[model samples]
Target: MTVILVTGGNRGIGLAIVQAVGTRVADATVLVGCRSTANAEEPIKELKKLGVPAKLKALEITITDDASIRAAVKVVEENHGKLDVLINNAAAVTLPKSTDLTDVRESWARTLDCVATSQVLVTKAFLPLLRKAEWGRVVMNSSARGSIGRNIALELPPSPHWLYNCSKAALNLATIDFRNAEVRDIPDERDHITFWTVSPGHCKTGFNNFRGVKDPAEGAEVIARLLESKRGEISSATFWEFEEGKFQQVPW
Candidate 1:
């Protein structure tokens, strides 16, 4: 069976991704990465009630804690031997409450740690297991607000969370760096593990106070589509989102 691990899979868009992959991917086992296993109990039960065929298990992980990350690697390594897919869905941003330099600095540091730095660390920790799999895939959950191309074009209105946008942009660059490093000198692309960054759009989750335009399930569709596609069908180190009834590549 394919072994998949989704960070923050207990709620919001992460839960939706778990549901989508569980129902769509044949012979799959989804490890829901939660800070505490107890947090996942209700969600797992609800998913089972919905008749999702894939096996679902709660995994203990705290992305910011190095010890927790190490322990998580050990657990997955001991149980699964290899990880076929990894979805980096857990992230946070701190909106500054004041215009003071200290407050802004604190927000930037914390947000970058949660959204970009910690994600890279988690990926690094799990990479050995990823390499052992037949076809490893890594998906970074990013946002269109992170897109420098879009910002340059003035495609969207200015967002107040500048630090959050910068952090995600760092994530996007890191995705490309991972792909370049993994695929270097690899003649056949099939043998190389693929990396992708996806924008889930403005989903109505607690993260945004439910003010977003789309549902979390609708936002997760693009990620599900990317995972289901054949290795060659989608390029690595690219950004994508499902928009207006079709999948579209988001600008980097």
Candidate 2:
């Protein structure tokens, strides 16, 4: 059975991804990572109702906490020998509601910690398990705001949210660099690991005060597809967008 771990899988788009995988991939094991196991209780119950063969495991993974991350790694090691797929979907935007310029500095620091820096740490901690698997896939749940071309095309300000947009932009570059580095380190194992950065589109989630163009399930379609056992022949190390019921390649 394939072992998949999705960070921030407790609610919203993340929960939708977990549900989709659990319902679709009958033989897969879904480990739902949340800040606390309590947050996963309801989701786990909901997943149980699906009556699929996929097993559920709730792991505590506070994105900005090293101890929490290490504990999650330990749980995965003890339960599953290896992890086949990792979806980095945990992110935070702690900026003030007033949209004040004065709070940008502090907000930027906190945003980068959760949105970008912590993802690198989580991936590093899980690399050993990922390598042990037959084929490992790392998916970065990114945003369209990360795209410079899209921003320019839409005529949005250069720094749309100051922290959130820039952090995602940094994540996009990191995704490319990380993929390239993996290839360089394992030229013979090219088929072993696949990396992708995907935009979930405008989803009506808590991130945007529940105002968006798509539902959480709709936003999670591409991500769930990527995690499925019978996946399509997708190009490795590419960016994707969930649009109009299909996953399309998005230019960085």
Candidate 3:
């Protein structure tokens, strides 16, 4: 069974990712990571209704907390021994429309903690389990907004998305940095781990108050596709965006 863990799996694209994996990969064990397992009750039932062969396990993980992060790592280590895939999908989106610099600063700090810093902590805690697997895979659910070139190409006027966009950009760089470090200090085994940053498109989810253009299921396709990819078929540290029904390389 493929032991896979997806953070923020309680709703939106994260929940969709759980279903997608259940649909596509048989015998997959999915650890549905959430901040609160009690809040995940309904979603867990829904995923079970999908009848995917994967086993859904609830993992309590508050990404912003160190103790929570370590506890999550312990659960997986004790039960699964190793993790085949790790999807850093938990991100808090705070829409700061305020023109005041103080408000912007506050929102920026909060969003960055959840979206960027927490990712580093979570990945650090789980790297041991990831390394135990013969071939591990790490994915960061990034955004096209993270790319300045894309923003210019789309002719979008700069707004209050500075904090959110910068956070994602930091995540993209983290993906690249982690991959390069792993490759440089690669183990003797040929089954090396890989990393990827994927933009799930502007999905109609809570992140945008359900005002986005794409559907959540559609947003989940790229992550599901990447999970199903064969080893060596993907380029580590490459940033991708699912555009025009296909995965396109995005400029950093």
Q: Judged by TM-score, which candidate is best? A: 1
Residue 228 CA displacement from its true place in model 1, Å: 0.9
Identify the superior model by lDDT, candidate 2 or candidate 3.
3
Residue 196, model 3: Cα distance from true site in angstroms: 0.4
Model 2 Cα lDDT, one tens digit per residue, 56-129: 88889998999999999998988898999999999989886555766666788889988999988898899899
| lDDT leader | 1
* Residue-level lDDT tens digits of model 1 in 50-126: 99999999999999999999999999999999999999999988887699999989989999999999999999999
Taken over the whole model, the C-alpha lDDT of each candidate is: 0.94, 0.84, 0.85
Would you list the rank order by TM-score, best first? 1, 3, 2
Task: Indicate the residue-level lDDT of 61 in model 1.
Answer: 92
Report the Cα lDDT for residue 141, model 1.
Answer: 96
Model 3, 93-145: lDDT tens digits are 66566869887777888899988889988888899899899788899998887
Q: Which stretches of candidate 2 lie over 4 Å from their true place?
A: 97-102, 155-160, 229-232
Per-residue error (Å), model 3, residue 164? 0.5
lDDT, candidate 1, at 218:
92
